[model samples]
Target: MRLITCSNSAPAYPAPTDTVLRTGAAGGLVPHLLALLRDGGDWLFPVRGRDEPRWPDRIGPVRLRPVPVDETDRRAHYETISVELLLWLFHYLHDTVAEPAFDARLGRAWAAYRRVNAAVADRVPAAADPDALVLVNDYHLMLVPGMLSGRPRVVYAHQVPWCEPDYFGLLPAAVRREILGSLLACHSVVFHSTRWADAFVRCCERYLPGVTRTGETIEHPGGRTRVVAVPLPVDAAAVRALTTADRTGAWRTELDRMADGRRALVRVDRLDLWKNHLRGFAAYDELLRRRPGLADDVWLLAVVARPRHRTPRHLAYESACRAAVARLNETWRRPKGPDPVTLLDATDPADTRHRAIAALSTADVVLINPTYDGFNLVAKEAALASETSRILLSRTAGAHDYLAPLVTSLDPCDVDATATAMQAALDRPVALPDPPSARRLRTAIGADTSADWLAAVLGTPRTGTAGRDVHPTN
Candidate 1:
């Protein structure tokens, strides 16, 4: 069976042919899917618009084909320019509103969207060959499932459909409604959370009542719609093992030096506002202020991803983070206390691994307080890796529902409450499960590897059988 995957963002690397990776955040799922396909299956990974300049150094054992389409392939610059001209003329002829008129910018964005869709259409293979599944992912490729003529199409809902406003900040109401309608035409739809699925169904009911949805609702009279939840899984064993087996011992020393004989507090994530990096810092800062005695004993390692954009908001946030770190250190750094909270940019693989291992080995608490997240894989990885590290998780995270029993929950937006939660975690001792029970839990979760999750949801065949062992390919 051949699977075609389309995502808005490019995969961090090409995955094995048997398991295709698409748009959305890069997390534990990427490696597991690659390993599954490497063991068996053919996979095709296509980015929505542009290809990466260089592929990642590893693809495990699976064979992968990188599908590349030029940004200019779908629409000629001259053609897009002409469409804008016609739109302006049509609006002028109808005497539409003059200042900041509606649907004015949409003309350009629409041209680009149409161009992207056309480019994917140009590359889409014929489905008459049979056994081909078109898997479209996220809002980036909402138009792609509709472009597939004969192939069985599936769309993965990584976020609430109403979150469209986040991506298309200025998209008109009419355009957003149309896009939502267009996206629901897929043969099947899969959401990670029931909350998101319900939100999607409600959105569809309000905007496109007559349209077919991949849900159990009467929208599909013949029972054609297939909508289900497949809470994405993380390889608990692999993460724990990889983290524990940190080949480089330098990270251990770094954590030791930073700890200064005290406990460690940690948060690992991209330095985006959405991730609430600042709010996390605020909680740690409050902890330092309220418990001056603990300030010297608990170090906060806020490892952030490198800044990817130069927008004013992004730059301002980064600046604020840097300033906060400096101020907090100056206020609380002591001769006998833990080293001043370290705000490190762990963006590179080596750096990220270093931080992960250090947190696993030394952290007393792991804070994952994202304002909103499709999934927070680190919470799972951390929980599996360290017996002593207590998890402080955000309630809004998709993984929160699954990791509830394993974590100390907090609202991502509440700094004071999060600070209180952190204190509570520190006051409490680590919770450990029986080794046999941990192993059993790990095995049960491993069965939901990205490949298995995708296969079950799409009703596709998996390469490895019930008793087969799967490994990553070189």
Candidate 2:
């Protein structure tokens, strides 16, 4: 069967030979696509740039088509709209307390957003058969499904706590209706967790009149949309291979030297607002202050990657994080002792991947304290990649759904609680074995590879609790 999927950026399948790196949740979907292609699934995706050659047009059974955006000005406008407006809107990143005002510039950006989606929709039919299964990905192409009405299509949401009615109300009424109507045009919708799925359904019910939900399916004027929750699984074998590689060993040695006999608390994430870098630093500082004896014995290794688009806000956040780290080091560093916190840049993909694996392997505690996340893959990756048994995760993270019972869950907004969890984790016996729940989670994630995830997304019947209520008493 012919399959077509659209995403904002092309996956870096067969990792580039250059030093250029691709990271984040957008590239996270690449491995699953690669697995599908290896298993003989016919797939097609658009490459963004007009200047870049479409070398290796076909990888195994998958085909690559370049959707040229030759106009540089329009391309930038489209990207600005997607990142600054649409992304923030869907991710709930805006400050609701402050009244928001939209000017004509935003209207122009929305127009560019429409143009970008139209460009993607224009390429879909040419790349697929008349009866092909079209799968649109994420908020970037929310309008693509509506554009391809009467065809079998699915749209997958990669963000959490899907848009509420108030969030939608921020947009002009016409734009809001257009987006909801476009989504309703799809035959099916998918999310990484049940919480996000429920939010999406609730938003529809609140905003769109005559919308009805029945057992994970939502019916509206255009069509009935089947909502499915399939948590994205980690490529355990790949992560294992990376962690066990020869380079990883060398990196581990270097990391050990850097640690200087101090226990390492590792956190790997992009420098973004929702990642909660500042709060994490505050928690670590609190941990150091509360346990003076352990201050010289413990270190925070924050392996933060640069943001995809270096907006002003991202730059300011990075500056603030650096200042916080500096302050913590000044206050907590003992005579001739290592800095209490070490920040590492993960801009080079190959080097970053190796360093991350090494950090995970050597970590005594892995801290994944995101204010919100779609699915914090770092938590899962740490579970598989680390020799350590302790992980402190945020309750708001979607990964908490699967790993709550296994991890030390903390309210990321609560600094004292996070500090307490960190202290408790550091104080735990090093010889203590991993919890049975943690082992089960690791096994379950490993067993369900990206191949299985792809099959389920493409309509393969599978039974299990992917969206079960997992409340951990911590």
Candidate 3:
């Protein structure tokens, strides 16, 4: 079949060894998308830059044709829509209120949304083969299915969390309808978790005007869409290989030396608002305050990946995180004692996987307390890497649906509760080589690869109750 894939990001060649000026963070999806591209397809992406070895032309290898969308621009408003608004919607899932500046931000977000949709509409219809199967990934290209000519078969995959009717209704009436209508324009819509897919159905029923739900099909004024949940899995074998203790590098050596005599509690995340690093540090500090005997016995290795474009808000958040770490080290490291926590920078722009190996391999306990996440791969990665490492999980993370029983759950906002959990983790310690449900977890998370997920996207039918929270079994 002739396949045409659309993504907001393009692959950057000549990476690492010879770095070029990049205006943005290489998004989490870039690597995954490249992996898919390697299997063969024509990928439509915005131009990365002009100075590369081949700028106006292709970048990747043969069998993969890179079609650059020359119409796109590097504007900040797009981020406002893709990151900020969706975050607020997820944040206000139960509540009806939003931030004071939400309305103003929404205005800018819509402008960028229309601009992107318009660009895709103008380019895709002309370039796509009549028999092409268009695969749109994530919210960045949600409107592409509807905008394109009705000839190609389009599949929309929503990789993030979706809100229920009550919260999703926060969008203005026209905007809400537009989004729903656009999604329904596709043959099928897929989500990373059942919770998110069910939420999408609920939103369509309550918010999409004249919407009718018959089984898994949601029929709106424009068209109908089949909703599906196909959780994406990390390359388990690949992650395990990267995190083994035997991996050698300068960074790995330095990191191992740091944890030579102490248990390392590790966290890996981009310095974002929802990652909740500040509160994480506060919990660590509280743990130290309560148990003076445990002082200097643990090392908190916070592996932070810094973005290229540091906005004012991000700058402030990063500064506060650093300040908290500094204050804790100063308070605990008395009389020339070692710092209790070391903020490890994992932003080499070249070899982050190797750098991450340094911390993940040494981890005695892994902390991932994001306030909200669609699904966190780190939990699964840590489990595969160090089966004995205790994982402190956040209640709001989508992985909580299946992982709550296996790991210690915490409300990221509750510093005291998190501190208590931290203590509990240290008290029992890891006796077994793996977690209690190691076999089950391994089976659940490592069952499917991106290829299987893509196949599921192309042909999986709805299997269970919509909006029903069912845990994945081994």
Candidate 4:
């Protein structure tokens, strides 16, 4: 079977027959994905910055095809239009009160966004067979589905769909129509959760006049598109194995020393604004303030991945988070007690993974708090990889829809409530279950595998009974 997938970043698992098309950036999972693809036979077409070195034509059996896009202009457009504008729009971050400042410059950026997507579209069909199963990923390539038109295309929305008509109507009428029209061109449109899927359909019905929803399918004058909620899957077995591996013995020992018999509250996230690092620090401070007794012993191990795109907002947030951590340490740290917050960089893969495994294995409480997210995979990773049973997860996170019953759910904005929950978790007789029980919980919570997720996306009949119900968004 011929398979073609387009994403801003390459897939973690690229089949030998797969043709993967993506854009190149400084940092992301792309580097890791490239490392894996170096030995595979998959065809990789990367739309790279003009200044970046061209990838070798071949690496073992894998083939590299480069598309050079002007870094200065394209990146300016991408940052402003795609990342700044569209990202905020889709994530529902626009300040309706103060309002968005839409001007001619932004309009130009939108035009460039179209041009870049057109460049990607040109390479997509060129890299695939006429009947290839074409899959487009995330908001970055929203226009590609329409560009591919009649192809057997599937588009996945990795962000929360801005369903509120008023929120969507903020964009120019033509731009709004273009997005919905383009998405409707696909055979199927998938989302990480049923809530997002439902939101997308509602947005279409509100903005596109001819659009009609029947069951999970959205029909328009152009075509019929199936709206499906296929929750992203995790490799639970791999995580479990990583936890048991003895390779990170030194790191685990260091983590144990740092904990010093105190309860470890660990969080692994990028220092992104939406990750809500500042708010998380506030919650931790509140936790210490409310329960003064625990402050002397409890340690918060926050391994933050450096911000990939150092936008002004991200830089400011990162600085503020650091300040908060320092303040907490200065105010609450005991001479021999664990630091209130210990920060680590995820820039180094080996170090990051080792630290992650160490924290997961040794922590008393794992905190997965994000103000809003497509799906917080760390929550699942902690569930599967950690010996810890107590996870304080944010209700706003997409993972909460599925893993809520298993974790102590907390509102990310509610500092007092989150502190109370943390205190209660610490007071529990068993902060974590036995290793065997942890494995059992992992199996029960991780209802789907990546293989199952791919099968569902490609419309192939499932040969295994490992996935959760793919219910209609309605």
lDDT (10s digit) by residue, model 1, range 1-474: 555555433445444452344423335434544444544433344442455334542344433444455555333322332223222221121123442244555466566665665555556566555666666655545666656644555554443223322333233566656555555566667765554555556656555546465434426322355565556666655565556564525777766776778878888776755678878888888877788888766888887775333345567878998988888888888865545688877645545654665666567889998776656667766766666778888777766655555677788879999999999988885665535644554455555566666665665736423111121111
* Candidate 1 error regions (>4 Å): 8-29, 39-103, 157-170, 211-223, 307-310, 335-338, 431-443, 459-474
Ten residues in sequence with the least summed lDDT for candidate 1: 465-474
User: Where does candidate 3 clash, by residue pair?
Assistant: none
TM-score for candidate 3, residues paired by index: 0.85
Q: What TM-score number comes out for model 4? A: 0.87
Write the residue-wise lDDT of candidate 4 on 274-305 in tens digits: 78777778888887777777776788889887
TM-score of 1: 0.77
lDDT of each: 0.58, 0.72, 0.68, 0.68
Q: RMSD to native for every prediction?
A: 8.3, 3.3, 4.6, 4.4
Superposed model 4: Cα runs more than 4 Å off: 10-46, 49-53, 58-62, 96-99, 126-128, 157-163, 245-247, 431-441, 444-447, 461-474
Candidate closer to the true structure by TM-score (higher is better), 1 or 3: 3
What's the TM-score of every candidate structure? 0.77, 0.90, 0.85, 0.87
CA lDDT of 254 in candidate 3? 82
Q: Is candidate 1 or candidate 4 better by lDDT?
A: 4
RMSD of 2: 3.3
- CA error at residue 357 for candidate 2, angstroms: 1.3
Strongest candidate by lDDT:
2
Model 4 residue 178 distance off true place after TM-score fit, in angstroms: 1.2
Ranking by TM-score: 2, 4, 3, 1
Stretches off by above 4 angstroms in model 3 are 14-27, 48-53, 56-73, 87-109, 125-131, 149-152, 244-249, 433-437, 460-474
